[model samples]
Target: MAERLIPRQALEYIKNKKLRPAFSYKDVWNEEHAAAFTVAKTMQIDVLSDIKKAVEKAIENGTTFEQFKKELKPALMQKGWWGNKEMSDPLTGETVTAQLGSDRRLKTIYSTNLRSAYQKGQYDRTMESDLHPYLMYRIGPSLRHREQHLRWNNLIRPKDDPIWNSIFPPNGYGCKCYTVAVTEARKQKYERDGVPAYNPDTRKTVRLPVQTEAPKPSYRSYFNERKGTLERIPEGITPGFNWNQGQSGRTIPVLQECLKKAQNEMPEAVDSVIRTLQNSTIYRDQLSDFVDQAYKHKIDGKANYKNTAPVGFLDKKLTEFLKTEGIETSGRNLIVLEERLILNGKYSGRHTDDGNAPIQQDWKNLMDYLADSPVYWDSRQKKKNLLFLKKITESRYLKIAVDVLSTERYLKLPKVDTMYYLNIATENEIGISEYNEIMKLKKIR
Candidate 1:
């Protein structure tokens, strides 16, 4: 899509999302939806791709809901996805009746995706602009409106208000409510001249008083079936739609970009970002959750087996050590690729009978091992990759091979190539020789 037709951020938000085939929409929860494009009961990859492409086109070309439904329904019908059908639920292992395609479903898909993309794009622009420091909530052009949304109408809050995280529209299904960025000068002009503000819901201009203070948010308990937890949701928001789409989409990318910029432009700020990431409870929890999900997917034989997550960054100390050895990392983070945790060929395959490979529980301790273990140079290898060995038991150790010297195409920044447990006492001749050689190399940490 051209930037002029639609906001580039909105287009990128949809275009950059990873395709995820799911049995239920709950399978991809909030914020996770920011990273993944999923349709409930759409198990086939091709069908999901077709729908996503249409959604992208709608956002790009400003297609109406009718146009989106018209262009997409025929393709879905041809693919045998029309009407209710029997589909196997991979998570529950039950054959359940699933609603696949219909006019109502298509409308929901079109509105939800397009609204989220535009809202996120608007948020990105809002964050970057200083002219508009406050956002005024305005109801959409729908004739019937939710009473709670009406109460929130004309509510003005600072851009950084925490309340926006919960009540940002689209708050519910078919919710046409939206927020417009208001400038201080314009707000002052309205107060001084008593200018009439045009209310889209009323389709009339009224002398509305400028309200800078937001209404107190009322929250209700919501049970998330997927996470099996109770969450507090604002009264006006739908259970799953409570989160701010723009903020959720911006979180990881913004942090990563900040770190990258700090590393290259402001070298002094690099350590601060890395230290904050290291100690961040949110970052650690996200890494842990990803590891758990990856392990579960692996056990379930899912296709996301090669998915990767950033575990930790190359700290200043580690970077300096690498510099002494004539290797440059550029202060990038390390990604723990799921392929490294597989117990098959290239990693503990020969010693599988002894169960020497790292299990799911061992993989969960990856962040700790990467953070605390002493790193050593592998002199036996031509690329001079770094190795991290942590004692899991008296005789067993967790080994993590980090490739730092490889080109960006093959190994972007430093990644954990292979990880497995090694038994020092009962090792084979080849294993013993390899261990002794690694132990003799110069330590980097």
Candidate 2:
């Protein structure tokens, strides 16, 4: 296939690997040179280094299969990397060949590189617009195609559809299958152009599920390539295809959806966001608390510090809190603490409730201890995390909250509804008029 047919999205992922392959998995789990564009472990590092340069060049230029074989053959031969031998990979202790000139190998290499690039590109295109939620597999017109992957042909499912994670195209060796982004428009277009293969019987189209129950091992199985760390596939991705070409840096479409919601009014959408942990798995740990303390409890601009951290992981959730005032974390110890602050304080959102009120003096004493506490005094660099905790406990808003919870009006709200609304109103940082409106609700509601 020419560069034009090589597939752009696949190139997007491959392009990322030019600097560093963005995945790691167990060597034993590597079945059939997974993402062959990556540096091979079987070859000596020095030998692989020369070979990688040519491979990278081919990828950069979109060299066709023939073009790659012609250019790389001479280089591999000159370096005496052309012959095979019984070999063991120093890294994984796996047996693989270092042979460079097999025609079959070149063709396989060409197809693998070009095909993966194309598929990755196609997947990305689906994410670029609102039109398509599902990708439909298209069987390439190869005569001897594998049967199992063929069974997936004409199937259209969501980008996040769990099956898509493990069963994306190229499901096996020499697999000649491709996927097309499917949208309502395309589905209709196909109906007009003769019933699409998706509905071979020409019956009414049936919508697919957004999620599939996790398959039983009898139905399907998944293998994880774990060495030291569980191979971190792209947040929601599957195994084997772990090493990202270059696509990880792109903004995720799902996250974009969240930001899109932010363009409107109050932070209700984000409050349900859960703000921490796995990108693939939707969660809501600190989000509820953030909503409670800042949105639910209503901190407004009352958090301690007159400036935000100048250096550290720039996160929107934390930055949202740094609206007008926050400390500039400049000192080395404080800067280290800044990272911890964002990690824990930024999202580790907490609030005081009437019945659950903390000891007001307890927080006061902790603040006093921190005021006198030296930075980096301990062997473990915990000063950064401690610095964040100190700010949260010492916030004037929190102190007042501890006192407010002790009051009868707040403490005696027996029903959760009463408590919930009160927290929402106060934590939401409403103006005096809104606060008065809430107060009037005490009489009206």
Candidate 3:
């Protein structure tokens, strides 16, 4: 038999997507959380809680549709959300009860959750594997189909195509549709030798150009709405299904690469330094949890004197610099944050907890490290003859240099390393020690 065009869904995939999906809820008027249909809230406190619990259980240990309904029904009934009854409302104290549990409502809840979860899981896989750049839309063989769905049945677009971000599968109630990521090689092959087509005359499959364009409805093509914003879902998409599944999976950057595309830098939104390094290039299998705790010291916050703060190289060349400093070699990973070192009262021990040793760098004397650190290169703003890293290196491999703010300089307990903060600070804010370090590293040549 010839190679099939439609790839069969992996049997295990249903369980996977059932556990995770990109969920975006907006009301009829496009207000988030306030939307009529939401995964976490369905306009009923009891119903919402029950559904959330059921969903969590599904994610925790894959639950069947029957199992979910069996567990959800009784809980909802006990909470007075079963099929509609009137009582004192919490918000207005008015006695009002709307239609609660029904076959249709339960069906809606079940399908919506499964669809969104699958979509998100697929999108995560798509992002992880950068090979497939195109997504092919496939509509089900349903007898009753939306005309628009039929029009978009066989449409294929680039993965980054704006249209895919706006519209994907399950665009309406009971709509059975999905997309498959197509590889570049497959795209080239199909373009060169058109897909197999049945020819009446020859009685055999013949090559024909695969369709690229389709009729897309003009209205409501995009929605940039947020909470409290009244907007409408994109045309031809389900009311609560307008948000892009893939983009929704573009969650807060746990790894550095995820933030590479960000317009503004938000470090606080990142995962723990140790977990981040574990997933990223900063990992050391032998170091364990200490791998993260070792290099993580706060560069911006005061070292609180009692508790330690996090910090690091915070650059792509961190490993390189560590190698050059002879501090972090291939097998030996010993870059402890300055806060981890003991300051006073020498105690009997095999290895001293001092960061000021030949191998260790003290957090109290961070300026010393900065003075000898590598220079940054700026392609967008650099002038050819400008001087940088004059006291450190002749090269400028980085664009940004950090400085400690003067107003925020003094810690309750000051140490030579504790003078500068570890975060992004400007020249005006730089304390004397930090300013001197900057001058040493990137002054006018």
List where candidate 1 sits over 4 angstroms from the true fold.
1-5, 190-203, 252-445
Q: Where is model 3 more than 4 Å wrong at Cα?
A: 1-49, 56-64, 87-96, 188-210, 214-216, 221-233, 251-432, 435-445
Q: Candidate 3, residue 159: CA error in Å?
A: 1.0
Stronger candidate by TM-score (2 vs 3): 3
User: All candidates' TM-scores?
Assistant: 0.61, 0.46, 0.48
Give the top-scoring candidate (lDDT).
1
Error of 3 at 157 (Å): 1.1
The weakest ten consecutive residues by lDDT in model 2 span 412-421
Decreasing lDDT order of the candidates: 1, 3, 2
Q: Please give, for residues 1-445, the per-residue lDDT of candidate 2 as tens digits.
A: 2346554555545543422221232342332232233433324455555555655567667776688788877776776656665555555667765554466765765666666666667666776668887676667657666555545656666665545545665554466677677787766555455333344466556543321223322232344534433443432223555332222323232333333444344345443342322231111211222223332222354443211111112133333433323423111111101112222231333423332233323322322322222221111231212112122222221111101011123112101111101222234442233333333321100
Residue-level lDDT of model 3, residues 37-112, one tens digit each, is 2442245554565675565465445566677778888887777665665545344456755566665677677765
| TM-score of decoy 3 | 0.48
Off by over 4 Å in 2: 1-3, 6-12, 18-62, 86-88, 91-101, 189-247, 250-445
Q: Pick the candidate with the highest TM-score.
A: 1
RMSD of candidates 1 onward, in order: 10.5, 16.8, 14.5
Clashing pairs in 1: none
**Residue 338, candidate 2: how far off, in angstroms?**
15
Give the C-alpha lDDT of model 1.
Answer: 0.74
Candidate 2's clash total is 25
